[model samples]
Target: MTPRLFAALPVPEIFHKEIRRLQKGVPGARWRPSANFHITLRFFGTMDGKQAEDLDAELASIAMPPFDLTLQGSGWFGKLDPHSLWLGLRPSEPLAELNAKCERAARRAGLEADSRKFHPHMTLAYLQGTPIEKLTRFAERTGGFVTEPWRATHFTLYSSQLSRGERNIYEPEADYPLL
Candidate 1:
């Protein structure tokens, strides 16, 4: 079966609690559980079995050095009416390079080069007609948010399956380790 997939850097388990704490007080926001926290490198959409295998091989061949990443601040995707509530990531050159590589891997796997600029953030929640005031307040309150630094040792290819309750269930299909 074709699997809807993406490449992402999973937030380390240790900081899950701290991340979850920031999800409160946002009305009309369907918060993501800690288990679903990830910073997507590339969203591959749906891929057939052959494409999935090819993508896996392309990603596995990437040579990237491990780097430290820090999560900080909070923000939403849209301006007036928010589309998603997310925690920001401190910019890192290594992280950008890694994302570029993943984009290349997607191209090698015969997918179109993802044209969107990489916005590094872990989605905390998706908004559905959420109040502008509430979203603004949440962003202001968590502006100083910063997590303990973590080393990114690997990136994972995840298959996205829609589970009950409209929540997405992401199953890691492969791990591409970095040196």
Candidate 2:
């Protein structure tokens, strides 16, 4: 069997609630639940059972120092305009180091390199029928909004499930504690 999995740093409940609150002001924007908020370190699209098990074992052995992270701004990623709405993560060496550790773990588990630079950000919404004007306006308004900071003590391996709902739901396959 193959499963869609990824490693990420979960956001705290308080910050999650704050993000939901901000979502209220954006017209026609769909919000993701707090439970679905995370800073994705690596995305392993789909892997067989053997590969998954090996990854779990490697992740279990990975070590990382705990760190504090803050969501400092809001932005979007797209060629012509904003496509994906995301909250930018503040600069923290520990956070970057932890991400690197996860990347190493992925390699140790025999996964291929992603080839893309890892920018730490918590995804808030995905653009579907959003117009360019609205996206640009929102980006300009909230580009410097700073959310509260919190300590990150752990990261998890999550399996994503596609649904017809507003946001994608993820299930925790395993969790690894940070040092």
Candidate 3:
């Protein structure tokens, strides 16, 4: 069966608790639960069995040095349009390299490049019908929000399954560790 999948960095539990606490205070935003929080290096919409195998093989071949990624700040994607709420990743070479590696792997696996440029962020919420003005003000107020830093040790290849519910749940199909 084809699975909706992506490569992601799973946040540690301690960090997860902190993020969840902060997200709870936001008004009118549909926040992603802490268990669903992750930094997606590449999003592969859906793939057949052979394609999934190919993607997994390609991901396994990617080699990058490990890095400490700081999860700081909250913001919205499509600021004017206001579609998604996210937490920004601090600028770091290792993070960039990892992102590039994931992109290359996707291309090699015959997946289309993500239309949106890779801006490292952990998704906090998805706007249902929130207005941009209020969203912008909320994002601005929380922009500099920071918690403890966490290390990104590995990236996982996830198989996402959609339900009739409000959120999509993903399970790891494979994992590639950073060197």
Identify the candidate with maximal lDDT. Answer: 1
Quote the lDDT for 73 in model 3.
81
Models 1 onward score TM values of: 0.97, 0.91, 0.91
lDDT of 3 by residue, 34-94 (tens): 7788888888888778888888899999987787878888778775667788889788788
TM value for model 2: 0.91
- Clashing residue pairs in candidate 2, if any? none
C-alpha RMSD (angstroms) for model 3: 1.7
* Per-residue lDDT over 83-176 for candidate 2, one digit per residue giving the tens place of the 0 to 100 score: 5788898898888887788888889989998898988898888766677777777778778878777888889999987777635779998889
Ranking by lDDT: 1, 2, 3
Assess the local accuracy of residue 75 in candidate 3 as a C-alpha lDDT between 0 and 100: 77
What C-alpha lDDT values do all the predictions have? 0.91, 0.81, 0.81
Per-residue lDDT tens digits for candidate 1, residues 45-111, read: 9978898889999999999789999999989998986799999999899999999999998999999
Residue 165 in model 1: lDDT: 76
Where does candidate 3 clash, by residue pair? Answer: none
Q: Against the true structure, whose TM-score is highest?
A: 1
